[model samples]
Target: MCDHHHLRSPAPVGIVDHVSSLSENFAELVETEDYADITFIVDGARFRSHKVILAARSEFFRALLYGGMKESQPGTTEIELQDTPSVAFSALLKYIYTGRMNLVEIQEENLLDILSLSHRFGFVELESSISDYLKAILNIRNVCHIYDLANIYSLTSLCNVCKDYMDRHAQEVLTCDSFLSLSQTSMRDLIARDSFCAPEIEIFRAVSNWAEHNKGQDPTPILEVVRLQLMGMHELLHVVRDTGLVSSDAILDAIRIQTESRDMDLKYRGYQVLEENIATTRLGASVIRGEMKTALLDGDTQNYDLDRGFTRHPIDDNSGHGIVIKLGKPYIINTVKLLLWDKDMRSYSYYIEVSMDDKDYERVIDHTGYLCRSWQKLHFPARVVRYVKVVGTHNTVNRVFHLVSFECFFTTRLFHLDRGLVVPTENVATDKNSALVIEGVSRTRNALINGNTHNYDWDSGYTCHQLGSGAICIQLAQPYVLSTMRLLLWDCDDRSYNFYIEVSTDQQKWVLVVDRRQESCKSWQTFAFDPLPVTFIRIVGTHNTANEVFHCVHFESPADTSVGSLINSVATVSVTSGPPNSPRPAQAQQGPAYPLITVDRGPSLSRSSSSSTSSRSESHQSVATATRVHFPQYYGPPPPPPSAQQQQQPLLPQPPPPQGLPSLHLGHYAGHMLQQQDVPEADRMDIH
Candidate 1:
């Protein structure tokens, strides 16, 4: 039929590229006076333009050119635009006609002017395009200026983009010359943002420099926006006290807030949500060669190279010497992560101090009373810091404190799983092997809380107890508002177990939070419930399909998988002091139950009938040969407790240093005592 139809088909319609030609025709009219019906005189430069074209392209111009305005009158031809730049007007006119702007041809400095015209003329598309272009081109050199212009123009989206850029580069932005040149209003706005990442001290320093640049400008208003309470006592007393920008009463109030209040938010500075490490050499950070004998900023947390870590010694606990890390610039930080020399079970006691200037330091952590091993994640009140000094007060194995790696950063991560100590019930007896005591506590280095799920086999990677005999428990360092938990049940084979979880503030009153006794479970399990202050958690297994023992490989609170798995034990802490008592079970609403989930079976490692005994013997020899750990032993009498009068007196002021050197005063920091509470003797161990 097609052959018979040999009729001529309509000529194929060719697609012509018409848009560019149309754009060119309009572009040609942009600078011409031909058919001109109106004239725009911007900054004394006259632009002969067509009224109909302007009316069609811009709502603002549509009203001004065709509406009942003086310029729209028949007798009116020339219209003067006030406060408008001629170059921007020309660029705007071209865009209006051609609908195209070659950003590569335009100077970055002039883009803001064009953007302003786009906003003023109600060119929504042009405004958006210009904003996007500006965002892509933003850099340390121009972001601050662009932010100011965006704020002035009330460009909400652009302003937020600029703010984000500034936050990520806060240290650089604060130190830039453009930052000092910003107007007082803009300066206050910039520093007041809760998302701003610089520390309070750095903010104060930058603003002070800004104030100096703009002489006669009162700094009180700008300084008021800084979170003074977030500053360490050293910065508060040495750096801010003399500024006179803030009143003495305000400074005292900030000191009171810092010392007496435990409001996490109040002590929190901006950048708490970022996960960037400011202590790495990649970020321009370095350990002071004179203070640290080796490099600890390399981020190598696994290697046991003796020459890779820093070491310091002390004749006694009061020695103030330690390794110091200097950031490339001042950064706001709240967390310090370091690897202890854990080739052995040896434990160490340490404290951390931070300083704006190296001369003045404020203690942020005081773990000298307890034992710590392997990975140590210490959190303190957020502060601006340039130097971090970690001083070891005691090392259970030797006179020297060895640290393998160190990292410092601001983290929005809410869970502090490392602070808890695993407390397996007496039924799950502690493996007496000294190798298992990587920290000061036995079984603290086991698989349950070590964060590793792949390295252990049937004989090791898991902690277990005979079903119905005893339970496994965890005692948090202190009561924390908890609502969720994540755990991995041993699942190298097609086996399932039944278990229940309970939480308690005191060992005498356990509240049932999770009851999986009726449901079979395997692999990773996440449990969530209403948040309550919890100090203890117990998991009791009721049944096991494959064997008489209940095995677990991992556990974490506020379930997060992004937390990097560590090659250590469950808890990194040990209880030197606590009470011993079993809590009677209490009735409570069961946490949300999870449905039974089938886990894919991996190749099973052969089980040993005497796995516990064999694991202990093997671990003992392996650990002893690789590392050494020990129980903490106090060589001297404990320090005297603060007197009631000493506790009542909140401030510890020191004399100002000579010259412009920083004052060594710590203000109320030293007097702000940690409220030591009694620890229950139930199951005391460390979390890995």
Candidate 2:
């Protein structure tokens, strides 16, 4: 209606406005629909929902698809979200809708939050994905925080990943505060994984520098954390020392902690270091020069080569310069004695040195002249030295100098302050009349004899008798606390026998703690007694009449006291008879009085009745009897007669069966025999 240009512009503007309005309406409708409904169909069967829906679903759904959810019960939801963040929901929905996530926008804090939710919901796939993301982003700056998050959620896998990443970049992370924080939070876990070595050195170095700068001020919280972490790495003791940051208190603390942990390697290293620093009372040296000669030596001399620049001299009469040995390690020589040559006596002077180098040598000990003879003995006080050089300055020259050996004994200034109990030396006697009689002996056989002779008897078919009439009185030099006793008994007749054990404080008094007469015993029965405090124990023969002998006796004490307690408590009672279930019954019982007793071999009996009518009639009767026999004495060969060769054999005796009972037999009879029996059937009851 107006100008032509104005009409054309208005038409175009109207078209653009209509298109814009339509596009807005379409987008709104798409947003309102379920995310699943909007699917991208790339192939006929391959369809993905819109990203919004994918991202909005909880991790539980991902876990189900990934095979992480084990149980899929109806009416049970694996995950439930309450007030989930808008961003998380949006991200989930976007993934569902588009099958892609904007990983760049996700921060570690948010990632961890989501990961926790995923783990809780059993979305194993999402949890793994988040873990991978964490690994990629882990750095010196953020590792400490990630470690904390892992610990808080009990995500051991994540924590391990973080530790590995930290260990790999230890040098770079040394100055990082986050690393320190991590060290403080989970030192034990890191130590358990052996992940702290590399980082620990770096941390020590950094802390040392910090300590120097701070001039003894309390270490920063970071340094303290580093120190705590180092405490767990006991093997890093030398590394800490090398860093020059280790304090006396710190070293001691480290030792205490390591000892409590019972880490053998750490404990060994600690001892090595401590020993190296402290002077020992025993002196030791290795030959460093010249050829060493020895007498009565039968091995290849080449195998005994000294350290570099040394050689062994062939066995000769004498007159060779002894190899000079230097002792750099401090030790105390307790005794000095040389191997006996058994040849003519040879005199030699030993030159000792205090310090020596290639350029200079200083003698701390004047030539201590000593005689080289058989059975020569010497003892000197402990000495401290940086070097101990021994040289045979003079000896019988070239006269077949039967040089057997040379040794200088010295004691250390310090010994292990705490000493363990010394094991009592076992002195076994083979004499039958001696206080102790050992039988059926092995290398480890030992026995403690109390004054009472009847207390213990060997059941292994061996006998031990005291040398004198007096009972073998085994007296402890001192009393000890006992915890346990073991006895090995042997049955010879292939029959089991029960025995009694008695304990006593005074040699004259006794108490019976075990009463096992009714139970069948074995050839080798181990009896353990409850721990008790006593000085004397006597094992007397209770059941066996056959000579009961003890093979080996072992006594163990919780604390060192008397050998008597240990030997009495721990012993072996070997029997000559077989184990239980042989030819012997367990116990003896009284039999019933009966006449016309009939014994049936099988388990049951049957009889037939007969009737007659003519001139006479007869009656039939049946009777049975079962009897068990008991033996009072063991039926076995007596111990061999004493002889020189027989004396060497230890006595292991077999215990005898219960005494005062004869073997019983069952019999059955009818008619004539029954009527003539002393006891009538009317007044007798059948017994077996």
Candidate 3:
């Protein structure tokens, strides 16, 4: 058994890739009609194919060709597809037999027809290809027609593209000849949206032009949704009514617009503004202020309108960079909502302001920069104001900004933005789900975001046995204002370790947010800094203060619970309720809470940058609770006695062990440190 071992490929060692050529051979058979068993007639063109192949590929073909009826019998084998085009049918048949589809020859008009035919026959791949092709070529002339088709087929992504295209080309779409063909509902919806690039008055003209196209039909109903007061009083009277299409009620609505538009009343307790026809899905997807709140509530973060992303210019820079909300009436607003763009490589530095009148703005949130796609719930002291403004002054990646949604509220409703946030890890052992942790940690992720502190057991917590400078990172799906991080350290090993903390909006460029690389503890750590928008957060281990292994029990954000109560002293050291020289040890002093004193790595992050030191009174304090956990060590038999041949062979140089770290031992929870008295050898389990 100890003699020798060898590895070899017992069977043929290499296999060539011939699947594509095999598919080509099957493709050729469609043209040759070799072993073909059925014929299909498409718009007078005849195509030959095998019955077994067609039955295998198409559900419709299988049912018609073998469903035990006259069509399944041997006598009549021809299938007539009167609706399919010859070119498309040929392509469809070839795909069924050879797993190949050639779309170069199909014309645009016929492609849509084939798209329908493919669905009728249950050819999934062909249908998807047709839809993708149509989506790519969408332009002003065909978007309206494509939009109608998209709705019919429930092709949501394609329909969204059509809507976005129309949003960017609103002016052209309004004047285009297709505008005359639109139904009243479609025109009304277009006019109601806040995303119109040409402003409110242009929509009035478009309505007038539409009425003229319809022999001067009533345009009053459609025009009522617009803010009539925004137009000059003379323009509303002279140009709008001159069309002879206005009604008495329409004139009344316009008269009310002047007073009603500026009335900031919060009579309604909860604004179900998202349901109003004024904001469509297309509006939710843009940078415009009107659609901002709708998108956030819709929970569709991935879809956004690039054309609507904008920032304000100080001196007529032409940027429409902010959103203004007139809260039906004023209430004391304590919370603001923002869901940043999804994994977008852009950062917007903006502010939140409130005012009784739109002109004299009082800053609610000063200069803040965000790069993550996470939802930010900004809380402030409740202040009464009718108007709210979100203004952007700077952008990191580009002048334009991408925002999935925006929201504001009078009540402070706690929102768990990272309920499903998946944290990414570097140089760590992952369990079955690619989540970082050693074995036995089953519910660590849930413990992190589930808002439960002091929630620990064998099934929850993270352990890393492997050695090196390991770090645990969470990549946010969106940028957010990361104000503080609350960590519940795992003290399973009486061992302690220190690690640096960092953050970044763009993953490639990093900023050192905290230097905790020298702190050691079994207690909770709260690293609170100024509010900064970050897409990535990392915990880089630099040293194991007393042992080799690392353990983390839970992680929580501010929204889950109120900031821990503030303590009198910044660094609070706790002594056990025991006599001096007692069995238990005293806990070290917890670090001081922040008005951060940061140490920058280099000029890469300038002192004046958004992550700069700032004064903020964040309310937080450490939770002091002792818990104990222990892990067993794996034991193996000693190595066999060195063989005569191994002893004779000269030793080779071994790889150098990792340097720059102190040596240590493991396995003792924070709650139960080792007793001062040594354990008896007999009681200790030693198998090595």
The most accurate candidate by TM-score is: 1
Candidate with maximal lDDT: 1
Q: What would you estimate as the lDDT of candidate 1?
A: 0.63
Q: What are the lDDT scores of the predictions, listed in order? A: 0.63, 0.38, 0.51
Candidate 2 vs 3: which has more TM-score:
3
TM-score ranking from best candidate downward: 1, 3, 2
- Assess the local accuracy of residue 488 in candidate 1 as a C-alpha lDDT between 0 and 100: 72
TM-score of 3: 0.43
Error of 1 at 68 (Å): 7.8
Model 2: lDDT to the true structure: 0.38
* lDDT tens readout by residue for model 1, 1-688: 1232235354458954456667777877875567988888889899999999999888888889888887788878899999998988888889989898887788877888888888888888888888888889899999988899888888888898888888878899998888876777778888887668766788899888888899978887898888889888888888888877777788899989877864433634444336887777777777773335454766666665655555454526535757787888767887888777777546677788888667777888766655556665567656867788888877767777777788888876563433332222111112221113222122234546555555543434555554656567664443445677777776544346789988775556889988887776755566668876565577888876544556676666756534323212122111222111112113211321111221122111222322132332111111111122221111222235456685555222333221111111111112222121111233334433
Query: Please, what are the lDDT tens digits per residue for candidate 3 over residues 460-555?
Result: 334232235345565454444566666655432223457666777655788887676655444356666776665566666555443334545544
Q: What's the number of clashes in each of the models?
A: 26, 99, 16
